[model samples]
Target: MHGARKAFACAVILATTALTSGQSFADEEVNVYSYRQPSLIQPLLDAFTAKTGIKTNVVFSDKGLGERIAAEGENSPADVMLTVDIGRLDTAKQLGIAEPIKSEVVAKDIPSQFRDVDGDWVGLTARARIIYASRERVDQTAITYEELADPKWKGRICTRSGQHDYTLGLIASMIVHHGEAETEKWLVGLRDNLARKPTGNDRAQVKSIYAGECDIALGNTYYMGQMETNDAEPEQKDWAASVRLIFPNAEDRGTHVNISGVILNKYAPNRDNAMKLIEFLTTPDAQEIYAETNFEYPLTPGVAIAERVKGWGELKPDDISLSEIAKYRKAASEMVDRVAFDDGPAS
Candidate 1:
């Protein structure tokens, strides 16, 4: 029976080798061109890899990814394009760089208002363009999008440049909420009250408030949570502790929330894998990871929010469809320039 035992061992070794070889062949690596910074997205990518064994390769760039993808055209190696705002996503769709993908998983997880009706792209997580008020300086009851333009807020408001995507999206939503004429007026008013030249990112705006440079600032809700929970630096923890997050326009249109979403590249080499990845991301499990890691709201209903997010209280998201905001981006940019906002330092 020694010869029989030897044969059985040989058979087991061959089976294991064949299994490993098959997995290596089916690995099917997907290339992702992401607008999000690495720190904000790598964790999610790692998780997906751990669960699916489908290796993910990513090129992270904060700017010009859309243009690069467009430049590559049908020859592009990118299988998916991930971006932060509706304006940028619309640009990709307008350029015909993204192809429509139909998946019941994506359709069910993402709200119709957060994606293209034709299924070209789907939103995964959402962030509100809300106000951060200094606990020691501002009255909570006086908070509103319109209030930011009030004379009282003059010399007390801090914000990043209107040219930034986050600010541009907020302006686009304003264009939708209050037509061009009124939006122009609000832009002028907000511009006139800037605490410093439109500089730095949302986190910088929050830091400025903590430094006593301003009493109120425009920023995303996630940044506040990031700062509070960040163990990497003491200053970030302090910045988060110094302010309170307020949902703007609660009574009227509700707070404007934007999303980070993905679309299949028009020239995807592995269309089936691309659809699977998109489907995986929109699932309740993946959506929860997004909310917990990125501090953004899940696009899928019934997904529980992270405890830190729940602490900020519930939000009444603006009912306006994201496409409406994307539609008015051109007008919003023109208004931004017409007011000479890019000319000199804001306020």
Candidate 2:
């Protein structure tokens, strides 16, 4: 009888040890697969951990991340997926990789237009698609999305490859405004005007203007603000000082805008924790951090713009639903390639 009791006690102890080890592993961390670069997202993750005692482990990659998540499917270890641009988010949704996130905090903080109509994802912040022109070489009043194609501006425009997501979205907005044929014509005309083969990111375009390589380019509003505020790169400040920002078509459709957003993975092990993180990100405090740190605008209504962002001035954004922008991505890509805009400068 004594020996049997001792054996039973050992069995109980082993079972308890296994259970405690499993719970410890589960409670200690949440996994995130992010398309946003690590530097841009680490602060938020750090803050979330400090507040919740839930540590975050992130895997950041710009490409193939969506595919990897989908491939993982029900086995995916990712609890949250954060990405910029509606196209990628929509792709994730269409691929059935994201589960609907039902949270009152998310629904209240983000606008209906910015969140998935079915609640699959929520936009956290917005970036405006705006025009940047060299103050010394171009007339600021001449700024307009259509003006980028003007013959007068030929040999004076510098932009990245049309194949890039930013340019694709910009051209997609044009398609929304003017239809496909007209957009193609505008793209061809814009192609003819390239000061150099489309090369570099938005910041590089500003650098081009500073070097007198070109006088005008299309860039995200945040990049402009970031450059202006960057004391680390005196040249970035000088480049920013030499350029002027123009929010296009304020009298018509208004300026085009895009978002950085988050979705709960379909197989998230910690759905409640994921919802909490998303809600936390949309709070006014987190929204302000997003704006100030990334040079983006808050998605939440009534949230005050950061001073540096406000200093860039107000904008009347196009009322077109961002979902509509996601819809046109493919056609926009085809139009870009058809015009050979990716072929560098025209002979």
Candidate 3:
């Protein structure tokens, strides 16, 4: 790891906030090993402590936290697993580290489509994989996942690495809904459409559109909010303004939706408090906080989104079960290489 990244990992692993306003859970704490940034989850943790007086300890990692927990086995101090994608959540479940939950509150508040059938994991928020179209260059207001493969769009699309987890989730969904053979053909078409070799984070794809390198791109919904509200990178605001988001496949199977979800560690030392925290995260109050702070769509009903996001229009999320989507990741990873999707267009 680079020096800065190593320092960041150490800081996130050791950092433990007490959330001590009225009462503290230093004694009744729940340990969370997360794949999400501490800043993104701190508000909810603080609210959980303030409401239930059960504090949380977090260890953040972009990778390897799961391996460490697996190595620790039943003696692990980890109480909860928090992450951003169904594939990761399902991986934890398959690794036998996740406990199957039996919470009525979670079942009632979270929709069945967003939670595992056996309750090993539950999605807290959802985002759509949609198109970011350049305002000045693209005339259309809508498109479809199928349409990306159309020859009309050749040399007009850009994306991050085809093998990135979010992109993998999308590719996995494509494989699930469309058979492997057809999906490969679609992959070839998409590959031939790239404005440049697939590169950068999702935000960089938007920047490419802003720079006129491509007319449209694939990105998650929350990133638009992040780009628009970013103060540190004020130019990202202009990047945000240059593109209009199009919800793909909206008139058909609906846009492919992904999630930020949570899990219960099977041997969580603080099982009761951990369950409390899980149930709390699924409730409207916490969902509202998540919606306002992170610009994510709440899985729970009746939670309104940010006004700016609301203006983008309603989401007709493809109701495909993400659990089913997780099964095709290996095939999707293979297809990316088979088609040389990251090498840009061959035309």
Top candidate by lDDT: 3
**lDDT of each structure?**
0.80, 0.80, 0.87
Native-to-model Cα distance after best TM-score fit, residue 249 in candidate 1, in Å: 1.4
Candidate 3 has which clashing residue pairs, if any? none
Question: Which residue segments of model 1 deviate by more than 4 Å?
Answer: 1-25, 343-347
Candidate 2 lDDT over residue span 1-347, tens digit each: 34422332343211111122224433555667788887787677766766666766677778877788787666666788899888888888888888998888888888888988888778898899887888898766535688778898889888988888888888888888899999989999999998989999999999999999998888899898778878888789998998888788876768888889998988887677777788889988788778778888898998878788787768878877777777788999999888889785578
Candidate 3 residue lDDT tens string, 7-108: 334555434445565553546778888998988998898888777776677888899776777777866778888999887888888888888988999999
Ten consecutive residues with minimal summed lDDT in candidate 1? 11-20
Candidate 2 segments exceeding 4 Å error: 1-28
Residue clash pairs of candidate 2: none
User: Model 1 over residues 177-226: C-alpha lDDT tens digits?
Assistant: 88999988988888888776788899998889889999998999899788
TM-score of 2: 0.89
Q: What number of clashing residue pairs does each candidate have, in the order they appear?
A: 0, 0, 0
The number of residue pairs in model 3 that clash at the backbone is 0
